[model samples]
Target: MSIAINLLPPEYRPRRHQLSRRVIIALVAGGLVLLAYVAFLGEMALAARRVAWLEGQLALYAPGAQQAAASNTALGDWRQKERELEQLVQNGRRWGQMLKTINEALPADAWLTGLEEDEGKGELTLTGGSTSLGGIGDFLTNLQGTNLWSMVSLQEVKGNGQSLTFTLRAVFPGAPGDAGKAGTIERAVEGK
Candidate 1:
């Protein structure tokens, strides 16, 4: 069997060399837009990631800041407690010395029933009873003669002829004022 091939004139035939210009332009534009959109999204995602990383770092340190603040509060409270305890100890020592001084100053026959120290007011209250009035008078004389006391006032005196009770108030270390400057205690208490 013979196969017949048809040959058209060159002018009427389709030209393979000429391409669809608008279609190619549209395809290139579409590809460029898609690429640009992808690039824009990538940039946005990268910025979001950076922000998240910064937030995470801050979150990790937040607990440390809270702990430091709590520690500071605790330290401040402990310091206050320590100061209070120190004040108590100092007041106790001062009272002990006052008692010792009072005991040494008292006569053998006279006895002290109460020796009270008021730390807030910084005063000592002496309440005692003696068997003889002469002994009480002598005690007062001796106390007055000493330079260690300032404002040594005999606040009250009661007697039953044979015995006497006395209430006296004095500042320990010494009397206040310009003489608030404390000198020697042993010398004053041992005066003739």
Candidate 2:
């Protein structure tokens, strides 16, 4: 080992400048904190832009959506009316067929004066005059035998020794429930 001695005065001695471990660690930590803060600000800006874009899209489509909703309701109403009209047409056909059946069942000595219908009760009233009582019996029998009527019964009979006036009630199945109007058919008496 060799001993060395410095003879320089204190004022003339060189000074050494160096960083400590704690100071270096503090500088690195501060730099990392600043980077994280910058990243956070960038994310906030992006989120604000996304929110504005969504609002714009909503405003663009709102008017058309309202119009479509209104049209959908109108279409629904039109479809309902169409269905009701179709039902009425079907009922008309049924009524025509029933009248044709009655005409075909008439006897040569009997004639119909008037025909009335009660749709709700599904009843038909026939007023007519027959040349003889036997003619009325035959008419009732014919109406009863047909598949169209559920039941047939004589309501009244009046005879003056020359001709007979009769009222017959017949029950028809599957009548319409909605009340609109009653159908009436009238004919002049055979000779009057």
Candidate 3:
């Protein structure tokens, strides 16, 4: 006699279906957020790798870059000094070959008390008791004829009737034989 069943309204039934759709939409949104987080982590990893690679490249080049900069500065300074020295030599004021030539022609018995070469000017002071006046005269005559010297003139002569002192001045002509040596020095200096 009491077996009747109570049923929901049609509107309530449709509300349940709507709730199902909302749950599915919420799940899909949550999945999208998780995927975005993973992608962001991957991007961070790639960015870190790029930074490390750039740092490594800098390390590899740092030493050589410093060395090249230092070398350039030193080379520039050396070049400037060489040019200045060349000008001084070319002005004919610094005769580098005068002293040796004079020494080569010195007599075995004659001893130089003062010998100097300065700015292409040569001065010599000699003291020796010659065996005879003829030997002293011959030495002076030979020095006057040498082409390596110019303005060969005697300065003063003093003798105590036995000992002799003589002073002379000459101009250094430089040596003709030193041309090849000069060129070699110039090349070696410029090679670096």
Candidate 4:
């Protein structure tokens, strides 16, 4: 045993602490870990909310989007039909109108024995009988004056004054190898 002596006064003495340095460091580290875990959870919640909102918006517009796609398909079908109709209108010839034109050009005394049409050659052969040669000439003149034929030529003339028979070869306006041009029915009728 040795004798002990106090060097500092009571007011200036250091107080004893319940926690050690290692324990305080461990407590601070645990608090920081807890704070990081809470932050991670908050971030996850925000992301989930955003995803739900986006899904709701997509659902709201889905019907309209589907309808618009259907409309686009229908529009394409309509355009195809319209093109087909236009092709039909352009390719089909008006025979009734052509025959009416021929009737209108025929003279009162002249009668047609045969009206032959060569579709491949696009030619018209008018075989008819007239009271006089002058009547046949008048008929040819009337046909030439119209816009129906690009070329009109007298093929043959038989018989005398009365009961004269004549054959006239006339080229359709849009026939190949002629100076005339092909056009719509309305344009041909208008002589344009």
- Provide TM-scores for the models: 0.52, 0.50, 0.42, 0.46
Per-residue lDDT tens digits for candidate 2, residues 85-153, read: 998887643767788888888899999999998877878899999998888888877887788866667
Model 1 stretches with alpha carbons more than 4 Å out: 1-55, 81-93, 119-121, 145-148, 160-162, 173-192
Q: Could you tell me the TM-score of candidate 2?
A: 0.50
Cα lDDT computed for each candidate against the true fold: 0.70, 0.79, 0.60, 0.81
Each model's backbone clash number: 0, 0, 0, 0
Residues 15-67 of candidate 3: C-alpha lDDT, one tens digit per residue: 53345778999999999999999999999999999999999999999999999
lDDT (Cα) of model 2: 0.79
After superposing candidate 2 on the true structure, give the runs of residues whose Cα lies further than 4 Å from its correct spot. Answer: 1-74, 89-93, 174-192
Give the per-residue lDDT digits (tens) of candidate 4, residues 1-192. 998776799778777768988999999999999999999999999999999999999999999999999999999999999999998688545778978988998989898999888867778899999988778887877887888778776777888755989888777766774564332322433331
* Top TM-score model: 1
- lDDT winner among the candidates? 4
**Candidate 1: 10-residue stretch with minimal lDDT:** 183-192
* Model 3 stretches astray by more than 4 angstroms: 1-62, 77-109, 120-134, 174-192
lDDT score for candidate 4 against the true structure:
0.81
Query: For residues 42-132, could you state the per-residue lDDT of candidate 1 as single tens digits?
Result: 9999999999999999899999999999999999999999999998886444545656666777887787777676655555668898887
